[model samples]
Target: MSVVETLLVFAVIPLAIVLLFAVLTLLPGRAKKARYKPGQPWQYQPVWWEPHPLHGPAAGNHDDGPKAIGSSVYQEPQAIGSGHGSASHGATSHGSTSHGATAHGATSHGATAVGASAAQPAPVSAGPLGGARGTW
Candidate 1:
């Protein structure tokens, strides 16, 4: 065989293969889908790092504007009612006003339920498998 042909067959092919492999590694590959795969059944695996579904904002629906609370539903902010001083100011005896506004019975905000602890699996112990020791 000619030296040029031997060089092309032996060196050029391997160099071309290596270059192609490097180019493929440099290019971004397809993103791995977390939800659905080709043949496997659809499964819902909850990731521990993500927010718990309970405390997140209401799903799908995003109309977060304030809604009607009591009667006189569409009144302007000034027309709604006056704010009586809160019970912390020792003013709990304010007469009931329009919309039954009162500082009394106000719920303390910022309270949350303690989350459950995720228990770890027990450790496996080594034991004799072949009919126990000295029984044979």
Candidate 2:
């Protein structure tokens, strides 16, 4: 065969086949679908599915209304020096002194240590709170 015919048979046919495949693969994705744009009112119907249909609002059980699920209530901020243990403040404990004994008064060497209270926790501190906060 001539050089021009051989080139056309090998290169041109394969390139045409590849271009045809690429166009066929990408054609379906080019079709437009419903899309949401910012500031535009949503036009689609909202759908909600509950695994337990009888317990949800769809079962005509609207007495309780829509209850907040896993919602947090707004709590009043406490004074920094209030010294009260509220939801926002955690109880701070001072140093705990425990000898070489377990909660059952048993020593490390299997001997009991009399008057040892390892089960009791350390007392909470009444001093001013101390912590640091920062932002970058």
Candidate 3:
């Protein structure tokens, strides 16, 4: 064969191989599954850094969001009611009043006022009057 023909054949063979591989890879199911690949069931098999005796990731770490006392869930500044393990000051965006307003009881998004004599309600008075007074 002529030198040019032989060289073309050599180069073409590898190029064809690479192009074939590229095409197959671009074709669905070769890597991540798509809707067209009906034969394959796409599943995300999570590899555990360690065995999960409790199943899923352990309770903390990347456990959704900031771990707090009452609620658990991550959410945006506005959507704090969904339950994703994050904490919110729960104060309204505008600095106003929480009066006659059930702050952290269920009316608000788990938010208590800054001086809310409730949330951090006098860690000193879990005693006689919900921390109101000494006696009746």
Candidate 4:
């Protein structure tokens, strides 16, 4: 084969291919970066970037009442008589022991109605020692 033809086949073709790839890399296409508002949620964020925990006024579409699309659903604390929950009753109660029922009295078998006041154990009165710490 002629030197020109051989050079064209081996060098010219590979050089053209490399130039074409370079041009394509520099071309501005539809793959533009998505810009997110500061402190707002983003589809892709850097590892160091932390979004705000609480939603701001411009965070999301809150037009539908107080609920937001991505915000957590907040529930008001249930009242004592709401029958929804016993959160106001302090610690959880087990077995049967209603209000006004003393701890010793409720020790009887098969009891119910353990009310809010009776569920919690009575706090011990501080003694003269004032909770002294012992080594052993």
User: Highest TM-score, which number?
Assistant: 2
Cα lDDT listed for each candidate: 0.33, 0.38, 0.39, 0.38
Clashing pairs in 1: none
List, residue by residue over 1-136, the lDDT tens digit for candidate 1.
9999999999999999999998898766645766555687755421112223332222432233111222211211121233211211122123212123222212122221111111212235558555546621
**Candidate 2 stretches greater than 4 Å from native:** 31-136
Higher-scoring candidate on lDDT, 3 or 4? 3
TM-score of each: 0.24, 0.25, 0.23, 0.22
Count of steric clashes across candidates, in order: 0, 0, 7, 5
Q: Candidate 2 lDDT, tens digit per residue, 1-136?
A: 9999999999999999999999999997884976756777876522222233345433444343221112212121232332211111111111112222212222232222332333322347879988999853
* Model 4: how far residue 91 lies from native, Å: 61
Per-candidate Cα RMSD to the true structure, in Å, reads 21.9, 24.2, 18.8, 21.6
Candidate 4's error at 124, in angstroms?
A: 52
Model 1: lDDT to the true structure: 0.33
Q: Summarize candidate 3's per-residue lDDT along 6-98 as a digit string, tens digits.
A: 988999888999999998888765646355555665574221122233432234333232223332332222223422212235433443233
Measured with C-alpha atoms, the lDDT of residue 23 in candidate 1 is 82
Writing each residue's lDDT as its tens digit, candidate 4 over 1-136 gives 9999999999999999999998888786644876655776765411121233465324643332221212322222223222211122212143222333232112111332234333333345567655567652
